[model samples]
Target: MTRLAGMMAKSAVAPLDRLKILMQSNCPHYSRFNLWSCYRAVLNKEGFLSFYKGNGAAMIRVFPYAAIQYTAYELFRPLMRALMGPHSHIGNFTAGAAAGTVAVTSTYPLDIVRTRLAFQVKGEHVYYGIMNALQKMFHENGWRAYYKGYAATVAGILPYSGSSFYFFDLSKRIMLKYFPKQTTTVNEEKGGRLELSIWAKLICGCLSGVIAQTAAYPVDVIRRRMQLIGMHPAYDHYNTAMWRVGVIVYHEEGMSAFYRGLSLNYVRAIPMVGISFTAFEFFKQLLRIEEHAPTS
Candidate 1:
């Protein structure tokens, strides 16, 4: 059910994700194009399915990514809470970061395939499909190619996931304090665990998405840039050294360059997180799924 919720959220936001990747990696075809123009270009050129170009690879990565992330958070939060106090935001953040790291490490190579697949321009393709993309990278670029942006991804996930689950747990605490009635009774079996109402979950998710995305976005761009190395001519010379890429982006396009696709990302992320959290909560509540106690 957690995986299902994550899939529901990821599928809905895929197009925006594609566009964000295109813009962030500075896809030459869509260079200097605004959001609408890029959408039109994708629609006109490759039909609707092109909007979900790498969605298959995304699914492959996201299943384990989301499952492990949420599950690990559940497992780690208790440990963190044991170490920190019940109200420690630092505990929540650490659990989230640990979860994100575990998930990313397990599924990162598939992420490279996803980005490379997204880089393909239907007619002029670098990779034709998911399997082909994996095979091509393995054959041509070798094992090291699979982890091009790993360092950046690891660095970025800390804050992104940290804030994400922190806000989630924090919101639960805040809501329980201010709107005690807003929490559901679904977690009674989990030793009086507090579960937020579905609406509360959705709202919490949106706020979390906005803050988390904003915080980690520039690092995301760096990771995307690193992943695109050799996928496009423009990115062929892009540095794999994460810091070097950050420096180059600054030199070439100034600080604003780091946040090129951020607006579109927010457009995608807001609802993405909202739906994901809501779905997870709704399903968990509906099925009476038992999870760890919510931090105080």
Candidate 2:
């Protein structure tokens, strides 16, 4: 029957659709484009492939992290605006902060895994899966390990997201101010000039990511060190004090230790932030969300 044949085709395509999503999710094209490039260069000192050490697990983590991050930003932001008034910077900041927190929380476990995987070298003990990583952490250091460096993650993401939302919003305003005609063109075709060019939005997002990342870099370093604490046998004594950990690293490996993987971090940051911001901007526009002019 025609109906039976249609159902068969749908079933055959379902797996392909899932596979496409999985590949798209796992691709490090964004990471490779940004901070990961730096990370890779650093890894080249060790070996060519060192840059991708924990990449398999990291890819898995990215799927959820990206989805949760974008979804939370989109879904929670407007609800925040509705409740707090559209033009309030306070509201925007709070919404952004909450969205960052929620997205990070949803994806923290995977982040922990990704960090663990990235830090892994050949012959290093590696986690098998998410549940295995959780079990291993709990078995070794109690439940606290799952949340290790979580404070730093929160500290970093809060400003990162807040600035991202704030600056991206501002950039569009500036773009509109400079190119009023674009708005008219956009309005004619895509509803309004407020729609913004894809390129403009990308530039705004990339700049925002840089500013936000700069502000939060130290916390990010702390977060990564904290996440890697339990993985290394020598670092077992890493206490909760961020400065203390830095001191110990300095004492052990001198100043260079603290910055061991910084190149990789930068490599991962640039493009990741660029893509993330671009994605956020595009999604926001796709949803027809208007940027409320910030009141100074």
Candidate 3:
């Protein structure tokens, strides 16, 4: 159910997702493009379907990613709460970071494939399909290539996932505090839990996404840049170290390099997180899962 919800939410923002990747990539050809210009370029060059270039890989990758993320969160949350107590935000943050790390480690290769596919021009296809992309990456650099930037990704996701879940849980509590009537009580066999209204869930998700994405975006940019090493012509000589990539981006493009696609990310993230949390919560309700806890 979490996987389905993730796929649906991702599909809703597929075009923007592609755009965000393109904007974030270290490819020199796309350096001048913004969201609208990139959209126009894709449309004119590859037609409408171009917007979904890597969505197949995205869906395939996201299923496991989301499944592991949510599952790990659930498993870790109770442990964290037991360790840090129920009201501590550190529990939520730690759980989220652990969940993100586990999920990313399990599914990092597919992300490289997705980015490679998305970065391709319409007729200038570097990879014909997912399998071909995998084959090419393997043949080019062996298994290590798949795990390129992996440490950076884990590092980035620590803050991204930690802050996202932390803020979401925090915001939900605030909303429930201010609008107590909007909260619904769920009677579980063990204990009762409060569920926020759909609107509150959406609001919490969006705000959390924005804050988290903004905070961790520079690391994300560095991760993307490192992932493109050996893949993008501009980064052909680049190493996979996070600090090295950060240095290069800063030296060549200045500070703004770290925030390349942040605006597009914000645009995509709000709706993406909103839909993801709302769908997950809705599904939990439908399936009668415990809802009082933070299930982000």
Candidate 4:
């Protein structure tokens, strides 16, 4: 259920997701970095279907990614709650950060493939498909290539996941406080839990996603740059890729380099997160997962 929800959420914003990757990777063809201009460029060059170029790989990667993430969160949340007590904000953040780290570490290779596949432009196809791309990467750079930007990804995921869960829990608390009637109490075997309206859940999810994505946007750009170390000319230093790319982006492109595709990220993330969390919660209810405070 979590996997299906994640696929549906990502599929809805797959086009924008590709656009964000293109813009962030500093595609050579585009003179500027506006969403509409990039959209038009992709449309003119590769036609409409181009937007979904790497979506197949994305789905394959995201299914296990989402399953691991949500499952890890569920496991960690209860442990944290036991240690930190009920409704601990720190517990929520810690659980989320840990879950994200576990998920990314487990699924980082597919992410590299997904990015490489998405970065391919019309008439410049470097990879034939997912398996071919993986084979080439293995033969060329060996196993290390799969974890090119591991440090950067872990760094970014820490705050990205922490703040996302923190803000989501905070938003729910605020909503329930201000609009008590919109929430109901569910009597579980352990205790009574606050159940929010679907509207509240969606709003909280959207706002949390925007805030967390924005906060970690620069790190995300750096992670992408590092991940493309062998593929991109500017990021050729594989051994010292993370710091080297950071220095290059800072010195060569100034501060804005780290925020190249932020707008598109927000565009993709808002609805994706809104739908993801809402769907997860809906599925949880249907599956009879306990609807307690700090619901994973």
Candidate 5:
């Protein structure tokens, strides 16, 4: 009976352990609240339940989106580290940026869907599904439409995801410094995994999120403008190009407009970052994998 119980425990432990490893290594890639936060801000004026606007489709999209992103980063990290060297933070940053780009590229369509859903008003016409949106957007705008905010998105991604990798590592190093005896990993023979407290992880994650968001918020605003389905009609003569978008936003909305949703972004960022980082570190420790976490 004891042996059977032990075997069952081992089986359970294996998947749980694997999950932890997956989160830490790929958390930045998979874990996030960008679309959700955007939706929430729109809904806040209408009602409390607004955040779930496209949640059903979004939830469906998230799994694959996350899966592709995490998997890509996992595959890319080693190549990046090998080529650039593990000790180089620049290598880590580049790996994170590249990983983010790959992940975003794989799931950009879904991201567009999520954004459309978030931007939807109750009576407004919204695309029915991924294919419909793609078709309609292309028919109306051309190929460039699909990648509407690609520049700002890519720019925002670099610092946001890059910082995540940087700060998480920095925080971990800080922890290790203070707690000299703490072990990030454990030998199964001795007992089991060594997990960092949720609080500690959250603090570090929040800090990472804030730093990254601060660096990238202006670009994010421009990205939103570019992504809008009907910005031209509303804003009139606004430039579609990224540099032009920045100029237009500054011209109309002024400098403050570039920081739209700043407070809300931070509110959403703290927990989002915490979840992403915590999940990531947890997974990394569990898997005993070493890789750079993205700044996002």
Candidate 6:
């Protein structure tokens, strides 16, 4: 269900995701245009299907990524509770961070392939397909190439995942406290677990995503540059050291470079997180998944 939700949400925003990556990676062509102009340019040059260039890889990566993160979160929750008794918020943040770290680390190779595939333009291309990309990367740069931006990814994901789960849980508590009617109980007699209304859940989920994305957007930009540094001349100069990448972008492009493509990120993230959070819960209840769990 979590995988399904991620796929549905991610597929819906693939175009925006690609556009953001283009700008974030400082692609010579697409980065030169504004949002509307970039969209039109891609459509005119590469056709509509170009928007989904790497979506196949994304879907493949996201399925296992979502499954691992959500499952790890659930499995780790009880351990966190035991470790951090009376500090539920802290537990939630740590559990989410751990889950995110595990998921990203596991699926990182595919992430590299997905970025390389998406970073390619119509005429100027490095990789033709998923298998080609994987083969070329390994043959040219060896296995370590797949984890080029691993440090940046983990650095960004810590705060992103921590705040994401924390804020969602916080929002639900607020809703139950002030907007009491907006939530209900599944096993009121036994579990006493509160299930938020769909609308309330969506609001919390979207808001949490926006907050988490903002907090981690800069590292995300760095990660994109690192991931695609060898793919094109535009980003290739940044292929020195990971810290040097940050220093160069800051010194040359100014602080704004760290936030490149952030506006489009918010536009893409809201619906994606909303759907993932809301749809996951809906399916969980429908399938009676994790019914033994204390909360949704």
Q: Assess every candidate by TM-score.
A: 0.90, 0.70, 0.91, 0.91, 0.72, 0.91
User: Residue 168 of model 4: what lDDT?
Assistant: 83
* Candidate 3 lDDT, 171-288, residue by residue in tens: 8767666666665444464365566778878988999999999988988877777777777677775684678778887898899878877888888899888888777777877777
Residue 205 CA displacement from its true place in model 1, Å:
1.3
Candidate 2: worst 10 consecutive residues by lDDT?
A: 18-27
Instruction: Output the TM-score of candidate 1.
Output: 0.90
Decoy 6 TM-score against native: 0.91
lDDT of 6 by residue, 1-296 (tens): 56776887788899998888888887778767877898899999999999998899999998888889888987887799899973578998998899899999999999988888888899898898899998888887898888989999999999999899789777877777777664655456446666666888899899999999999999988999999867776777877777888998999878998888899999999888887777766776666673332332
Model 5, which residues run further than 4 Å from truth? 1-49, 126-132, 181-195, 229-232, 288-296
Please, what are the lDDT tens digits per residue for candidate 5 over residues 82-174?
Answer: 988865677767666777777677666666555655454444545765677778888877876677677778888888777776676677667
Clashes of each: 0, 15, 0, 0, 16, 0
lDDT measured at residue 123 in model 2 versus the true structure, 0 to 100: 47
RMSD of each: 2.6, 9.5, 2.9, 2.8, 10.5, 2.7
User: Candidate 2: misplaced stretches above 4 Å?
Assistant: 1-47, 79-84, 126-132, 181-185, 189-194, 242-267, 287-296
TM-score for candidate 5, residues paired by index: 0.72
Which candidate leads in lDDT? 6
C-alpha lDDT of candidate 2 relative to the true structure: 0.59
Candidate 2 per-residue lDDT over residues 97-144, each given as its tens digit:
777888788767767775665554444447765667778888877867
On the 0 to 100 scale, the lDDT of residue 284 in model 5 is 64
Candidate lDDT values, in order: 0.82, 0.59, 0.82, 0.82, 0.59, 0.84
Clashes of 2: 15
Candidate 2's displacement at residue 290, Å, is 5.5
lDDT of 4 by residue, 1-296 (tens): 66777788788888988888887777777637487888898899899888888888899988788789888998998899899987888999999999999999999999989988888888878798999989989987899889888898898999998888888878877877777676655547435556777888899999999988988888888887777777767557534757677887788778987888787788889888887778777778767784544434
